[model samples]
Target: MPFGGKARWGVRSTVALLAAITGLFLAPATVPATAASAKQSSAAKALAGKYVPVMMIRKQGENLCDTKVEQYQVMTVDALFGNPDVRLMRNNGSSKSTLIKQAPTIDDVRNRGEEAYIDLPGDPLGDTCVYSKDFTRMKNEGEAPVAVYAHIAREKGHSGIALQYWFYWYFNQFN
Candidate 1:
């Protein structure tokens, strides 16, 4: 299912959206042979790290009832799906989850956009404390610190290059 209102799109950790917009002006109208090769260089990949958002977490209220865990993480898509506890759930009428082949690879993600999510164990509406602990445990279990999937558009004869990055988070906690 669509992540509902819990999904966050914030300035702190969403540089892809901003960089993509900047690329519009910075990218040349046409890439020459040399320029095309340079475009494929490590510089483009390096830019993703530079552009990765610096997420800021707000503290939970004194009662801790106002919110769940204040921690928000950006993890490698693989680290999430590769974890045994993380299940690849099909977004459908039925709640049954399909077995992913050791979790989907980057190529698989490109092929199956929005088709599935790495669902952590526990109810989506579970207690905030429980979710908070689970998130902590998952992080402690060696989840990757960050991941950004970058794609340089490959359209034949395309005028300008379109650089895009896709970030996958463990959970999209709106609160």
Candidate 2:
């Protein structure tokens, strides 16, 4: 009966581990929609047309075995369906890894928004590089960038770290 008991215990432990991993993959609905976010939504609604999505990914420094990878994407919204629905395409600075996320909340463009993000290391093999960049700075320098709904974000977990990535939204006077 001791062998039976050990097997049962192993099964229970495996179940518990799976449960915990599943929860980490699920995103919570508690992401706050603040009052300021509401204001920005209104402004983004005004620019709901066609814009382009342009992006570039490169290693900020020497491509060390453990260096972080930096990705930059820009989207131009021009009022499709009187709204923005453009998706972005991206690579992992090497592979054709594709991810599709949601378009900006109207509030994003209204607030004249900007975002700076750092993607922590994901893999334990040291094949992935750290992620960091200034979304606004790239645009301010006239990069003619556009946003992609796909690159907006997705939850990723590895090496005991969880991270979220999303697009930065903005509007220009179309000079």
Candidate 3:
């Protein structure tokens, strides 16, 4: 029951959602070879517009349990991609991270580009309170909290594809 019952849960709707979420829209159907592709892309974008979620964020500066967790921002994957401050890294199998690129694009991520993970600026072993504070500031600087990464995965011998959504957060305080 997401999107306030505006978008239905179905294969076609899912495709539209994918197009919208990924920001990949189809071109015009002027050419004979790309007629179908253009039509589908246009339709998907139109339908996806209704499904965009209106996030409800907690009041900023609100304190609860001696913490200001409400100030955390919920951001989009587009916000993270192409961001100069974010670094895309890959593991070198020796407990070392190799820098693949700075601010990899969504297309790079969708295409399974070189970078497997993104490294934030703060130190992981630093104090929790300090990390939280720095993360909040970082969030305000350019990053938001929630960026969803989705892909269609097909298991071997499986009947259909699985729409997988991975929600990315900057810092997990509860962890």
In order, candidate lDDTs are 0.50, 0.29, 0.51
lDDT of 1 by residue, 56-138 (tens): 56744444334564544565545554455655556765766675544445444445657665556677575655555565565
For all predicted structures, in order, the TM-scores are 0.54, 0.15, 0.49
**Candidate 3 per-residue lDDT over residues 38-142, each given as its tens digit:** 665454444434444344445546332235545344435556678777787887777888887888887666655554877766575634455456556666675
Candidate 2: which stretches are off by over 4 Å?
Answer: 1-60, 64-101, 106-126, 130-175
Candidate 1 Cα misplacement greater than 4 A, ranges: 1-39, 49-54, 59-69, 95-115
lDDT of 3: 0.51
lDDT of 2 by residue, 1-175 (tens): 0001122223210001111122232333365655665444332322221222223445334333323443333333332112223333234565454432234343333433233111212222333422222233434565424433311122355343222223443321121
Best by TM-score: 1
The global Cα lDDT (0 to 1) of model 1 is 0.50
- Candidate 1 TM-score versus the reference: 0.54
Query: How many backbone collisions does model 3 have?
Result: 1
Minimum summed lDDT over a 10-residue window in model 1 is located at 1-10
RMSD in Å for model 2 = 21.1
- Arranged by lDDT with the best first, the candidates are 3, 1, 2
**Model 3 alpha-carbon drift over 4 Å, by segment:** 1-38, 46-73, 107-110, 113-115, 124-168, 173-175
* Shift of residue 26 alpha carbon in model 1, Å: 22
Model 2 vs. true fold: TM: 0.15
